[model samples]
Target: MKLIKGTLVALTCAAMLMGCESKKKETSSIDVKDAEVSKNLVLDLSVDKVKNTLGTLKEADSFPRNITKGQKDWNLVGVRDWCSGFWPGVLWYAYELSDDPEIKAGAEKFTAPLKEIAYTPADNHDVGFMVYCSYGNGYRLTGNEEYKTVMLAAADTLATLYNPKVGTILSWPVMVDKIGYNTIIDNMMNLELLFWAAKNGGDKSLYDIADSHAQKSMEHLVRPDYSIYHVALFDEKTGEFTKGITHQGYADESMWARGQGWGIYGFALSYRETGKEEYLDTSIKLADHFIERLPEDGVPYWDFDDPKIPNAPKDASAASLVACGMLELADQVKDNALKVKYTQAAKDLMAKLESKAYFSGDTNQALLLHSTGHLPHNSEIDVPIIYADYYFMEALVRLKKLEDKIAMQ
Candidate 1:
């Protein structure tokens, strides 16, 4: 009995020591290291370029056009940024990288008008992307309840704005006798906001709607070629696919760069959430086409084969968006070769944009310049855009990962 008691005491002491050692181990929040970041290529786009751009322009209630010294064609469509769901998102990404007070201040300029967006009786599914990426992400990083209040209000607005009977979130409000556009591939990108709302709002049904639309997107929006259709019509009652088309693509027939980027990124996220092979497969297939179409410089034309239209300079912004998507794609694929190829493709595109269109010897906007947004409609025809800035920074993060892998090798 004495011997047994001694052994038990010894074991207890050893176990306590082991537990202490385990607890003593240092905890790292994130393993990502920038040491692998390519030495000659770093500009700290978050800090330097954004500081320069913001220096040139003030946060107007509206977007500034023809407003900056470098701006082309002095026309203030100012709505393009809003169309991408306005300020918070772009600034959210901005602050995440820089932790800049200026970016936070900049985010507020759009909030008042954007609050109206959440409350507006129209079905612009992008409010989540527009507002949450900024306000929600901001609150998450900082733990400020004010941002949460803004998001809650936004969710209420989105809930009111939601068309429940349609079984999908309508993107744009009805414009005079227009069929409410209940389904668009772009909404796939917007669903993240709904998922977030469900999380924060305690509304499980909100996520159900978001999930249903995503399933529909996979079912009806993707073609056999794995090229995604831009729009699909659904029966409001049944959620059945009634019809689908390519509204934003060239001639309703070709792939649009930004839309494709949305598809790849959205599908990749879906896979990340569900770990489903189909989503992963779909992401890989679309990614394959995106990679195959890259110009020698790794930047893509707005449309992959845009008929070589005369006087059409390239859309470097589109290239940047695709590059950002490819970087995410690199993370999803399990195959080593696919991972290296996608990551390298993204890095090569970044190198090209940085060297060619994105960089200026003295200018601080080192990510990209002269991007053409919606040339056919003549919107933001040729200007640097915020999404381009966001994507460019995201690519750099991925590039940093690639660099780390290279260092490890």
Candidate 2:
């Protein structure tokens, strides 16, 4: 049996006292449906935005972190940065959408720097973001054998962090205090790399590790209501659960917005790769918990259970991640009612992201806005982030394909 930590008293106290209660107004609204016209409009607008933004970005051997100002200047980060892969990912989506030679070449060039990360050892749990988004998309588009090799190396490195006794991979080996064995919800996203490795004839142990890690996450990181904790701490020697807490969330008991997004996206991908009904069911439950707490607009505050709910900053990246996961979940469900419900939720979220409030104007080169990154540290507050734009574009591209299939039906 699992330890099942987290004091219910703390949860009850946080729920009763946390989350702001305010009815905010939206700047505008658009009805997004599964239609050719609506799909084309969004797709065309996205392609143009991406092309223009890429033009502003300097053509160097690196990736853009975020737009510093109006299209005139941009910030660039090295391959070691956690966000290095998203720039190429957005470019790859552009190539997929338009099939333009310029965009294709740009994607390939930007992805080149990331190949080094595959072989380099990283103790953090974001290797999937670093390698998969860049090399993974590159391989998917071009069938490049080199990209496959890099992915295999990355998967092997990621698997090294797994502790069989703990039943999960270590998320942050070096925390402030570093007293306990820890796993995080974000680690779930990395399992896809392991799943991909096993499927591609790399190693069966990769699949077993991923499966066990996800099962451990479901049992410990997830609360009874399906809201997730940011971290699950374990006793290193006996693998006994010690505590559950949040490193970046507003409070230890609060549900971090981005963590839930990782849970939703990671579990959905797991279900797709393994055909596991339990994973799918867990994803749906998490999605419902997420959707039910959202404000009038589909976007969410940085921390769902934060004390300052209505006044809290919105994390558009989390919204994008969850919206993408919802679309995937909609596709996998056999029940028509569930399929329609989730599909509509996804569309509404996408439409909301494109609204005047969330979408950037000509002033900013970044596509999406109002993302709160590490609010507790007072860093990158209410600014556009690269991953937000990457996942937003991904959701839009996926929505277009879904519309095309609907039209064919």
TM-score against truth, every candidate: 0.76, 0.88
> In candidate 2, which residue ranges exceed 4 Å CA deviation?
1-39, 68-72, 176-179
Writing each residue's lDDT as its tens digit, candidate 2 over 264-377 gives 888888888888999999999999999999988668999987787788899988888888888888878889999999889888888788877787744466778788888889
Single out the weakest 10-residue window by summed lDDT for candidate 2: 26-35
Expressed as tens digits, the lDDT of each residue in 222-252 for candidate 1 is: 8777777777776656656666666556755
Enumerate residue pairs that collide in model 2: 19-306, 20-309
Q: Relative to the unseen true structure, what is the C-alpha lDDT of residue 312 in candidate 2, on a scale of 0 to 100? A: 83
